[model samples]
Target: MTATTQPLHGRVDPAALPRHVSLADTVGQTMTMAWRATLKMRRNFEQFFDVTIQPLLFTAMFAGIFGGAISGSVDNYLPLLIPGLIGQTVLTACVATGTQLREDMDKGVFDRFKVLPISRIAPLAGPMVADMIRYFIAATLTFATGIAMGYRPGGGVVGVAAAILLAIVAGWSLAWIFTWFGTVGSSAQAVQGISLMVMFPLTFLSNAFVPTDTMPGWLQAFADINPVSHIISAIRDLANDGAVTAEVGWALLGCLAVIAIFAPLSVRGFTKKM
Candidate 1:
């Protein structure tokens, strides 16, 4: 009888592997993943429809349909409609994040990602960071459409910039909730349906397309309490009055709260799937 010993050929040294990824490493990996997501967006140009065509089309349709009815003229409605459209567009753009995330997960993209030696949060956060570009595009086009339609913002350039920044931030914050949904949802279609269900009420029920005072008492109360309403009001104050009011503070606070709550939840849910 003979005993045989196995050779250690091509064996990996356990100590050679990174014990803990550093902060800088995590950030770098996140940025790398973000670049990948951006490249995907560029390749699939249709992914940009929500940020571009939708904003322009909706702005025109709403202005044409409701402008004269609400504010006596399209020009008069620009100030209110533009800000509301910015919020709506940004929120709409955010829906794609969850839908795409679910699609990727279903396609086994995240399964491949699970084997990579990078920060777990990077996969979830990267696409979200890349989505900021869509938010910016939607916000910019909304403002440009308003300007083209003779909607002069009294808040000037600085005010408009602030409003755009607010819209992007708010959109990014709200996206975390959808990302969490994507992490838990069974399919891309399911996530899209859930996102739309949440978006319609928040957007339409808010003071987005019309004045809250004109609404019934109960609806007005809901609109006043809606976070979307606060964000839109903040945008209006910044773009129409050139002022940072308490609404701006509330909007930012709400964004922080959403990120605080949903970001962790998304990460946890994603980890469970992994």
Candidate 2:
């Protein structure tokens, strides 16, 4: 072949390189990144504290504290608290996504990805995909703990299953917000601080622990509009009533909206760093 057509002196032709990572390649690379993240989790076993221990601690603690005051008994409170706690735990678990990403970047881990021809989002998304496992664990253990605490779900197995799935999806989508924060935050500690600030209000200000009507009018207004409230309400409908209510649809739509907005912002911010 002519020098013009072939690479000169073993130099690669610019056109021979792919300008963009294909959908398939991006998926594969993302999975590889997920595998890497899992290994990190295994080595840093303490990374599992929130999922493994918090479920047991909070489920029992909250039931005892608020059960009698709210619903006249711990057993009676489980139906409401179980679903609410699932949302709280899953969302709380996702805060680590941004913190860990910030930590990795601070340690110069992402710099290694710069030399590889892969999707820009793979590094950002891979750990988050692995984080789904944490969400699953958190949600499952919360339900299991609730069950052990004399809490029975009227939605039975199928409804509980659907709620768990929804919680996982919500966790994954919401993680994109933290992932974006990771890209923009100055440090891991800064990311953690900001994430907690955002997370606490989102969790506590909603109808996660109490009935919305219990709050004052303005607070109830905020609770009614809180996406976390919608999520908890959706879970309650599915797990306690076995009903796929309008709240479920709204919660999922909110999740999709979060992904659409934050995913792009995360990718853009991550790429700018590259």
Candidate 3:
């Protein structure tokens, strides 16, 4: 009898593996790492204090200042501006993903991770996942402040819940863009600075503060087309009017599109750096 040739040790063909096993080995492991990162935020309770306080401060500060300048009554603008605050919070939360990534990389945390058998995407995925807490806190405080200031949702509890959920998904999806930046940037300072540059224009140019129609012709045109504006409109529609429209559907689709595009880019960037 002829001796059969031996296959390579520790090498398995992915195609030969059962579908469930492949998913468990790959996707399940990535999700577990992601969940662990979220758990890190959950167990560190003190950090929540800062996260909760800052968003409230911004909500109150902006609501007071802008309400007077634009529409006069804080209560009146609550319906209009609450969505703006939510959008602002979501945009601000995106920065933390990059900042945390840089902190981890600078502290040699990622270098340690690199030696493990974990998926290459874990480092980027972890920070993106952890930031959901920040999104939740900011969105919660934002709406709470709005309510305290006399903003009532015409759509009732279900509408309010839906708006909050939409804002969270938007925030999480947006974080992927920053995650890509943080993973590939040369330094932490670069990541932080770049994040600000990208976010500032996106936030300010949209219909977050004043009506887009009030702007100059060209600027108004751009703002009208901005994805952020669509998101703000969707949130406003849900929170204030309780109308679920095509605009909301478009906003959700846009967010998912962002995630689909940037998440793969982030993963590739991480793998290339390795």
Q: Estimate the TM-score of every prediction.
A: 0.92, 0.93, 0.86
Q: After superposition, how far is residue 240 of candidate 1 from its true place, in Å?
A: 1.0
Clashing pairs in 3: none
Off by over 4 Å in 2: 1-18
TM-score of 2: 0.93
Ranking by lDDT: 2, 1, 3
The sequence of per-residue lDDT tens digits that candidate 3 reaches over residues 1-274 is 9986637554444344333334455666667768877787778775465457766887788888988788888877788788887887788778877777777777777665554555666667766666777777778788888898788988788888888888888988888888888878888899989999999888999998889988999999999988899999998898887889988998989998998899899888775665
Give the Cα error of residue 38 in candidate 3, in Å.
2.8
Instruction: Give the 10-residue window scoring lowest on summed lDDT in candidate 3.
Output: 12-21
Question: Best by TM-score, which number?
Answer: 2
Model 3 has a clash total of 0
The runs of at least 3 residues in candidate 1 whose Cα sits more than 4 Å from the true structure, single-residue gaps closed, are 1-20
Q: Predict model 3's lDDT versus the native.
A: 0.80
Query: Cα lDDT of model 2 overall?
Result: 0.91
Q: How far off is residue 147 in model 3, in Å?
A: 0.5
What are the candidates' C-alpha RMSDs?
4.0, 3.5, 4.6
Which ranges of candidate 3 are over 4 A from the true structure?
Answer: 1-21, 42-50, 112-118
